[model samples]
Target: MSYQDPAIHRYGQVIGLTIAAFVAADLLWLPFSNITVDSSNGVAVIIAGLIAGGYWLAGAVCSRMARRSRLSKVWGAIAAAFENIAIFLLAFIPMSVASCLFMYLASSTARPRLDAYLVDADKALGFDWPSALAYANSFPMAAAVLVFCYAALTWQIPIVVLWHACVNGRRRLLEFCAVLFASSVLTAITMAAVPVDGPYLYFKPAASLYDHFTNAGLSHATTVEALRSGPFIFLISKTVGITCFPSFHTTLGIVITYALRRTPFFFPVAIVNALMIVSTVPEGGHYLVDVIAGGLVAVAAIVGVRRLADHGRRIRTALLPSE
Candidate 1:
């Protein structure tokens, strides 16, 4: 199908709006109020906001350019709105909170065993790989990737949104939502139960790259320390410290790929995302086990959500008459 197809455009719109809402929340509400910027937590929020805003704005402009039938436009707007609402309440907020809670709970539960393990693991693995991975994990690399990604996704989001707006009578939105919710829930549960400070932090510091990237984190840490901050700084540091078995970068990359699988533009995006995610192993100081676990989580989440959505659709179709 042509990239300009309405169905593709509509899908883009939904994804764009979904991303935009999260970004807007971070920029407008979450950063200064709910989360403090003294630590690197602010970096995640900032990136989310920028990417989301860029996608949302780009989608809006594309919608205007498409100038489809009134009904199509209305449906597109409704879909976009619905997607934004669902993503915020169902995916973004809950997932964020759950991730935070899981990290804390995992830390408390695993600290004793984890500390001892880290000593041995560090001796065995050393820190060179971890350090290189740390450099890859740094702000500069992430920023560069995000910038490139946002530029590409910006153009693609509009195309997908408009396409969905125009063609395909299937109720894919509900299906998409069902999958997202289930995947997020599963991820949260797994995160809570299997929290491990990833290999780099636990087994060994990625010494080489860690030394380079650690400087930024250390600088940030030092600034906070100089202020004589108490619990908040500690909390932030802890949040940054743990990096156990699972690789969220891989998991989320897979999720995004699955979510956009139906769209043509998703092809290139998915490939790039997959590469970026896999690179996290060496860049983010994760072990092979971490990457594997992350990939498994991603697959499970996608499959579980899809199955549930399919079942729901079957039930609905059985009850409803065809128009």
Candidate 2:
């Protein structure tokens, strides 16, 4: 395998190991906690796995056909996409599972919230979260529009990763996946340590233009109970939890923008993603500091991934015999 191949494979290995650890933790916590595993998420995971596996199987067939028949660019392109199917799936599913697992573990522990500190920081930075929220609530139509744009995050990540993995080269896909996973790890750790519920829950903004609390479709009481109990189920239909330290949504917005930065739609992508980030304040229940931390994480991931890639290339080149 090439240097990059091992690096890419390591992502899968790490996520798989982390998943195992989560399972182990769940089992260990079963004695003391009341959380029960909801099989729905497991079903979702299985379905996703099967779909990704199907892509790989189809890609392999196309790749073999391309190699055997007359050289054709169209077929080759198709085959290239199939070959990267594994990269897309491996990058996505496992990372997602690990995130959900870690989130459950952290929240269940019931660590003291850092909302007061985040609020103080926001005030110090001259960012009035409540005023910002009131402004958002003032324009119902605008808030609605922002909410829709922000909600795009659910599909945006998978679509972008799949599109790039198929159309772009493996290196870009690998780097993007690596960065996402790394950023997730950072966000999870920060959340576990500083566990804040965000401005929405903190301030209890009146239910008017923004009814995010209801719109979220989650019962805060049930969610808290699940966190404190055993089985620690990751629900498929309701993935949102009480995560608010460094805003993962804001981080995702920056990452998505970064992913599409070099494309022809850079300006439009930037504008839309900027709105997504801005929307996090009211719609996502995020503090301003959360957004800032998320952006910093994005920058770090981007830079770190590139540096690792370069270092891998150097090591690989050095090991090769001189001409």
Q: TM-scores across all candidates?
A: 0.52, 0.84
- Candidate 2 lDDT over residue span 111-138, tens digit each: 6777899999999999998788778778
- Overall local distance difference test of candidate 1: 0.48
Misplaced by over 4 Å in model 2 are 1-33, 39-42, 209-222, 229-233
RMSD of 2: 3.4
lDDT of 2 at 52: 81
Q: Which stretches of candidate 1 lie over 4 Å from their true place?
A: 1-91, 114-178, 203-206, 209-243, 320-323
Which candidate comes out best when scored by lDDT? 2
Q: Which pairs clash (backbone N, Cα, C closer than 3 Å) in model 2?
A: 33-230, 34-229, 34-230, 35-229, 35-230, 108-227
Each model's lDDT comes to 0.48, 0.70
TM-score of model 1 relative to the true fold? 0.52
lDDT of 1 by residue, 8-108 (tens): 34444444454454444345543333233355655655666566565456556545644765576665665455334333333343345334533433344
- What lDDT is reached at residue 266 by model 2? 60
